[model samples]
Target: MSKTRCLLLAVMAYDRYVAICDPLRYSLVMNRGFCVRLVVGSWMAAVPIQVGQTYQVFTLPFCASHHLHHFFCDVPPLLELACADTFWSRVTLHAVILLFAVLPFSMIVISYVRIIRTVLKMHSAPGRHKAFSTCSSHLTVLTLFYGSATAVYFKHCSRDLADTDKYLALSYTVLTPMFNPVIYSMRNREVRIALRKLLWGK
Candidate 1:
C-alpha cells in the first residue's frame, strides 16, 4: 500500500516538473492522459520491484540467528539478515540498487534540478522568492527521505548492519513521511489559507 502510494506520488511530482519546468515542452507535455499513463507506469514498475524484494526475503539464507535490522522487511534489511556466504548477495544488492533505487533517484534529481533552475530564472524578486519557498520545501523533503536511505546504503550497510540500523531505517520510512507535509505545506501561506478555509467552512 505504501509503496503504491509513494510510487504514485513520485510519478505525479515528476509529471508536474515536466509540465511546469521543462524548457521546450512545458506547455505541450503531460496532458491529463499522459499524467495518468505516467502514474500507471510507476505502479507497473513498482509492483515488480516490490515483488522482487519479497522473493529475495523468502529465498535468502537467513538462519535463525540472522536478525532483521529494520522495522519492516525491506530489501536491505533482509540482505543484512543473510547468514550464508554473501558474495553473490552483495553483487545482487548493488544490481538492485541500480535497478530500483538509483534509477528513481536519478529521475528525482533531474526533475528537481530543472525545477530549481526554472525558479531561479525568474526575474521578479517576490515571484522568485515564492518559487524558491515552494521548491525549497519540496527539496527539503526529498533530501531527508533520500538522504536517510543513502546513509543506510553507503554508511551503515558499507560498515555492516546491526539492530541499531533499524533506527536509521525508521527515519527514512516513518519520520520522513511525518515531516514531509510539515516541511512542504506548513510554511506556505496559500496552503495554510486553504487549510483554514477547509477547516472553518468560510
Candidate 2:
C-alpha cells in the first residue's frame, strides 16, 4: 500500500505538471491508454520492493517480545524483535526507502517546481487561480502522506521507536487514506457538482 501510494502520487504530480505547464498537450499525453499504463506500471514497480521487504521480515528469527508499538506490521517494528544481526536487512530496507520513497518524492518536488513556474506565468487572475486550485489538492495530499512516511522510514536504524513515531505511522497508514477522498472531493468543483447532481437529480 505504501509503495503503491508513492507511485500513484508521483503520477498525479506529473499529471498536474502536464496539465498546468502544457495544457494543450495534456489530453494526448495522458490519454486513456497512457493512464492505464501508468497505473499498471505503478503496480508492477511495487512488486519487487514489496517482495524484498517481505522476504527480509520472514527470514529473521524473532527472539524478543512479540509486542509492537505500531498499529500495523512494518519493517521498523519487526526489526526490533529479530534475534540475529539485522545489518543487511537494514541496508535492504534503506534501499527500498530510497527506491520507493526518495525517488518518488524527488519526482514530485521537481514536478511541483515546474508547476509553480508555469502557474506564475499565467497573466489572468482566473487562470492562475484555476492552475493553483488544480495543483493544491494534490500537493496537500502529498505533503500529509509523505511527511509522516518520511518521519517513520528515514530515521536511523538504531534509533529507538517512540510512541510519537507510532502515532505518526498511524497517521500515515490510517488517517491519510481516510483524508484522501475528503481532500480531493471537497477541493474539486467538478466532484461537488457531480455529487450534487446525483443527490438532487439536477
Computed on alpha carbons, the lDDT of every model, listed in order, comes to 0.67, 0.86
C-alpha TM-score for every candidate: 0.74, 0.90
Estimate, for each residue in 87-165, the C-alpha lDDT of model 2 and write its tens digit.
Answer: 8998887888888888998999999989888878889999999888888788888889888988877776444657778
Name the Cα RMSD for model 1.
4.4
User: Tens digit of lDDT per residue, candidate 1, span 26-74?
Assistant: 5567677777777777678767766766776677776766654457776
| lDDT value, residue 101 of candidate 2 | 83
Which 10-residue window in model 2 sums to the lowest lDDT?
155-164
Supply the TM-score for candidate 2.
0.90
- Candidate 1 CA-lDDT value: 0.67
